[model samples]
Target: MRAFRVLSHAVLAVTALLAAAVPASAKGEDGAPTEAGTTFRTATAVKQGQKATASASAGDYLYWQFPAGAGQRPTATATVNLADVSARHGAATWRLDVFDGLRRRQPCASGEPEKKAGQQDSSVTLTCTLRTVRPWAERWSDDPLPGAYYLRLTVADGPEEDLGLPVRAEVEATAGDAGGAHAGGGELGAPLHAGAVAEPKDGWTGGWWSDRWLWTGGGALLAALAGIGGYTLTRHPHRFRSRPGAG
Candidate 1:
């Protein structure tokens, strides 16, 4: 009985520790982290066909990072939910710029244009698309490179004080069936970027793995099960013993 009680207490303590270590969801400004190599804050990862939300004021610059596979093209669309005070500032123009992993501005094949937010408009959407990711070679020149890409959003005209507006960003990457003839080399052989492999700080790196609550919960459950199994096997050792020489 004493052994059982001690084992139960150990399991409970370990479970509690695991639960405490799990990170919680961040809210408001806390959810965003400062982008590496830049002062802009980064929100949660905007997966393909999924939307991620962030808050920013007028004239505030926002940045987001997304991954692109070789022979794949990525498209990002951002919609700004302006506050009521934004209407007083008249029409507002917003710009979305796409950059490669090296922070070099890459030209978009389509959807790279300034969007105007009128006084009556409650929201404005801007989209930017990049060509297929390809290697740099003599055959294919000046093409957009693959790997990680960054999108920068800025409001050119708006009320300066009207900050804290909500913005939704949606990103999508489409992969081709096979490599094109003109697509210089093969897939991206090198690493995506230095930032891609960096460990996330406070679960707010804005990558797909930022949300670790599910993983941690699963781990805790597994640990509890293992502990129970160990205790049962040890406590019931006689059950496994051959009884009366019966096989």
Candidate 2:
């Protein structure tokens, strides 16, 4: 009995520890670590396109920009992975907007694909397969100056739900000793896709709760209720046992 009690306590302690240690690694649809890369500090969900940060329920959007000096300029390919869209993955279209260091939008290559057709899309557009893992790549000709560039990844139609689905993005930079257009020219500019691999690996360090007292008190109450129920059951085994006169 003592050994059993010890084991039960150990199991509870382990459960609490594991729950506390749940790393905030944003999970993909398959629950695997999504393509590993630097996750920007600002992440939001929206239905419509907008130039800045905001939340949304539903609507087509213009574009969202990561802050200046926030991430690498996507010189090569920037992939957006959307997960858990059983409702509208195949129906929605995505437009990838690329901006230069000066925030001047660049035009797509001639006959380049696009997400959805719009008047401004001729300048920056990438048509992606609906609801699947999509890559909006900048052809070498479309490469902008090495520096901060905005990637406006937007999608139209496809899936609709009460909550916006989680999307993960990865930007792949070119690998070589050749400094891009900005190198050796006394230029402070870096390629759009540069420095992506240098992003930190560790995530946020804060605990689950901002205030300790509330959750601690709630947990204590739950533990007390469990203990009381356990004791009551232990004291009256006959209540749960088979009746002497009835099968």
Q: What lDDT would each prediction earn against the true structure?
A: 0.58, 0.38
TM-score of each: 0.56, 0.31
- Cα RMSD (Å) per model? 23.1, 29.0
Output the TM-score of candidate 1: 0.56
Q: Candidate 2 residues 89-141, lDDT tens each?
A: 34445555555534566654332234443222222234311111011223443
User: 71-177 in candidate 1: lDDT tens per residue?
Assistant: 45567777777767433557778888877666778777788447988878877888877776654433345556545667787787665544445544333333332
Show where candidate 1 strays beyond 4 Å. 1-24, 27-44, 85-87, 136-142, 159-182, 186-188, 192-194, 197-247
